[model samples]
Target: MNFLADLLDLILPEHCAGCGLAPVLLCDACALPLQGPARPARTAPEGLPPPWTVTTYEGPLRAILAAYKEHGRTALAAPLGEALATAVKAALTPHHLPTTREAHRGHDPPSLVWVPSRRLATRRRGHDALRGLVDVAAQRLRTTGVPVICVDALRQRGRVADQAALTARERTTNLAGALDVTSPTQIAGRPVVLVDDVVTTGASLAEAARSLRKAGADLLGTATIAATPRHHPA
Candidate 1:
């Protein structure tokens, strides 16, 4: 099945989602920036769980994410999700991962909980972009022997203004009290990681962590494919 998909991708001549110059979904040039080692997100908000990102969100990385998330370039999910899987591994080191005995006791693999997209945004994009990426990331991790479960456990509790034009502080203020967990039992007492496509001010990640903690989640960390320069200035 995987071979067939790869063959199809080659046969279809799909342009690169990042640069649109290479004859592939993600060309080598664009993928290079996403190959960085995952590192602790230095801009994590004071109260949020430790977060990790694989690459700086700029240039091709930013373009790829925007295309996947906002422009309906669904194929970009594979590469972006794989990048997310890398960040997840870095966030959950030996000390952070759940013990085998603990996993057996709970009868649940570690959870990958994604920040939910706004209903309107999902509708406009014709899909839940971040959720799709989380699902793919979980699959990729499992293939490499990382037992994990992707859970659609977070939901938007209210509307929020677009964050693009907002400052870091405004983004934090706009997201306050805006998220809620769908099920406490799913996360309660489980080692979990929050997932998102990108982190800017960390406002969304912070809110998601708050809701997870309220649900009794043993939230280990957060993971994303990229982080904006606002958080990692040159």
Candidate 2:
């Protein structure tokens, strides 16, 4: 299947999502923003884990993500996933070295838990966009010897309204109690990093963290490809 996909790519080369350059999913100029010095998100919700992002959700980066996520441009996953891997690395670097040493002593590395999109949204889109991104990111991390594992431990428990027009508080209210851990055992005692494609109001990630912690997961932090450029009150 992977070979077939590669063959198709060769037969019908794709243009960069950020720019119209052919033969690449994303060009170097557009990818620069994604290769970033990740920092804690400015608009993180209360009680949410420290959130890190590669870039602000705007410009070519925003357009590329929206295309990949909303328009079925799955080919963009390759470059976007690589960018996500970089963000994850930046988030984990300070503690990853010590964790690596512990792994040599037989301790398992941290587990990655992707915060899935709402069920209705996935159904509407006919695919779980976040899952594909998570898979690709995990694969990239493993290739670099990160000693990480991807775990699908979260699911939505109720419907959430479209958040695009919702205020920050409304977004939080809408997501409250909407997410739950599906397998507590898989997450129990594991150092977990929550993954998402984008962070806007931070409501969804905060709700997810609450559920994981309730299930006994050691929530380390969160990582995202991009974040909205709003000045969140500290």
Candidate 3:
């Protein structure tokens, strides 16, 4: 199934993933919104740096993400991943003594860890969506000379109901204690940024953060491609 999906990605996809306008995977105009000066997320809980996002999870961005995640439009990973790369860079800039990657060379570069999806979800989709995006995001950063490490450090412990219909409080409860670090050695004492595809109520990021901190990660902040509209305000 995965092989067939990859084959289809190359042969199919005649329209832009974001706007469906034509001949390219993503048109520049549609990619504009993903380019952001990442801002503090409105839903950030106390004690964690706000997860910075590039755009609101709506319109073209939403469509593109859905296509890539749920529908197997794997080709869309390039643009979305690059957008995630931008968000990651922005999220770390302010905290560094100097803004450029060159300046941070002396110290160990931060690790980018993503929220792990459930095994059931991965099986249903035949793909681990967010992990693919994070891999690309890290690659995009590396091509531009950023020193970084991408780690698949978190793992889900047990089943939880689908988050699609959950309210903010319910989401928090459902995900509480649902994730754990697979290897503390990979994250311990290192500055880390949590990555995700979207931020709805921030329940996932908060839970991920909790596990990473417990494992001894510095927990620089969180970064995502987009966030719910209410969290992305004007």
Candidate 4:
């Protein structure tokens, strides 16, 4: 670890995000609570595509994920990325899901695409937060021969309110016309997995899915590191 990272870790002190065990951000015992193999998560608006989460975004998991996104805890990205890979593997297992799951997984492994960060946020944050998890996830998926390819499929066209603080309808409006596909050919021939960090309203992924489909891509599903299980509009 770099001095800065070491300093950060020192100041914050690394503890298991779940159970507070030292020497690792996520200890085996804490990770053990995640049941079963990875599988596709049931998202609303049926017929769109299958979506997946490595584990429920609740309790200790929620704290860990929120730290990475909203609280500037970038070091946790690797673990979250691994969790996402686990979710993708579950999504791939036909037995774990309903019979229709085969229809999505049998052919080609979907190319993974992160919901392109808004230019403003990229500048403000100085790093593509979601990209870290996406890249590591692709690396993890490689172990199973699932091809996770990153393509600059979506581009943010303009400014939008923070999805975290917005109403669901506002989020939809904020993301309207926000993305454009520059290379449809790559995604057109295979399924594309829309990726992001948090899935509060899911407006971001939903819109990205819409844009990808409009560009003629067959989307397998979406995946994220953290998904707010319930929608309580603030």
Candidate 5:
């Protein structure tokens, strides 16, 4: 499966989804159509702020991410993780400092916590996608001299339905209170960032953030690979 997947990626990439491309998932010309996100930072849903999507999901970015997550493209983690690190650094420019343990909305420390998938999902997929990216992102952060901490301290409290077939409201309700910190002592009073694949309604991140808060960790905003566009016209 892995060998075949790799071969198909090389020889059979479709045209850019956002723009018809010259026989590639996305040509260089169209791969970076999007600049950084407009409101690149946020603390909460009501306070949802600028989000940095380093690349638009139109061309190669979409294909790369989809292949990595859905198609088991583990080999692409290095480049994709580097891109994600760039996106994260771009958001942390002003206060990429090692000043204090307390993390404000804008000034975040280096620690990253992932919103864990349900046990069923992880078992079925046989990979922890967020963890893989975080590992590489942590390395990239270190190269830039940013301290990074990966705390897999959070775990799924229960299993839920496949989120893809659900409505936004369902996604929200399904993930509520579904996470908790396993090691409360270690993360106590440490600044932390929540990492995940994507943010649609912000429910999973919120629940994880709430757990971290309960365990005495400072919460920076969460980040993801992709997000559903807000307010698409009918």
Candidate 6:
């Protein structure tokens, strides 16, 4: 597969998802925004875990994510997953720096439960992009001694329409009762951080959180790569 990919890359040189630079999946200049401090998502829904995001869903970050998700540019997952890992680390224990004792003693961190995208969408896309992001992020986190585990705990209960055209309220309505916890035994009494690639109205995350809580998991907030920025009252 590596040989095939390399041959394909040489034949059809890949352009940076952010800039048009050749051979790089995402360039450093475009990655600067992704490395910026994680911030609260703008339009969080009630019952949604407190959200942490790396950047706004605009410009190069948006383009990169769209290319990875919509266009099946799976090679971009490494850079994008690194960004998500940074956000997860920032949100994990904001004030308390990890002690050398804890780091060396091998304290287990909470599980990261990724909210699976809609089944229909994943079927059409031929891959689960969010799951890929979670897998890579978990690997990076473990390398940093975070002891994170990735689990696919939630499943879509039914088909739902695309949320791009829906209002925030409509999104909430559409996602209500739309997620189910697949393994209560695995999640029960476990601390979990919900993860997603992008957050718009946060309806999907909220629904996933509800399912987790119902199944006895301790919900510990959320981390995402980007969020749709919200307007504040002047």
Please, what's the RMSD in Å of model 6? 4.3
lDDT of 1 by residue, 1-234 (tens): 245644664577688878879877889989987777898777789988657998888888877887777666788888888889999988877544545555667656789999888899888778889888888888888787677888889988889999899998999999999999988988899888998888888999999999999999988889998887753356
lDDT (tens digit, per residue) of candidate 6 on 1-234: 245644665678787888768567778888788778787777678777568888888888877887787677898888888878987877787534344357467644578998888777788777999899988988988887676778889998888888989998999899999999998988888778899988998898898889999999977779999988777899
TM-scores of the candidates are: 0.88, 0.85, 0.87, 0.76, 0.75, 0.86
The local distance difference test score of each candidate is 0.84, 0.81, 0.84, 0.69, 0.65, 0.82
Candidate 2: lDDT over CA atoms?
0.81
lDDT of candidate 1 vs native?
Answer: 0.84
Q: Which 10 consecutive residues of model 2 have the lowest summed lDDT?
A: 1-10
Please say which candidate is ahead in lDDT: 2 or 4. 2
In candidate 5, what residue range of length 10 has the lowest lDDT sum?
34-43
> Rank by TM-score, descending?
1, 3, 6, 2, 4, 5
Best by lDDT: 3
Q: Which stretches of candidate 5 lie over 4 Å from their true place?
A: 1-44, 47-52, 55-62, 94-96, 99-109
Ranking 2 against 5 by TM-score, winner? 2
Model 5, span 117-154: residue lDDT tens: 77775665578877898898878887766767677889
- Which pairs, if any, clash in model 5? 39-50, 39-51, 40-50, 41-50, 189-216
lDDT of 6 at 174: 93
> What's every prediction's RMSD, in angstroms?
5.4, 5.0, 3.8, 5.6, 5.2, 4.3
* Candidate 4 local lDDT, 1-234, one digit each (tens): 145754675687677767666567677766663433554555543345556765667778876765565456687777778877776665555422223344355655567778887777666656777888888888977765565566768887677777767877898889888888877886786766778766666777888888898889877667766556665599
As a whole number from 0 to 100, the lDDT of residue 53 in candidate 2 is: 81
Off by over 4 Å in 1: 1-13, 96-107, 231-234
Q: Indicate the TM-score of model 6.
A: 0.86
Decreasing lDDT order of the candidates: 3, 1, 6, 2, 4, 5
The better-scoring model by TM-score among 2 and 6 is: 6
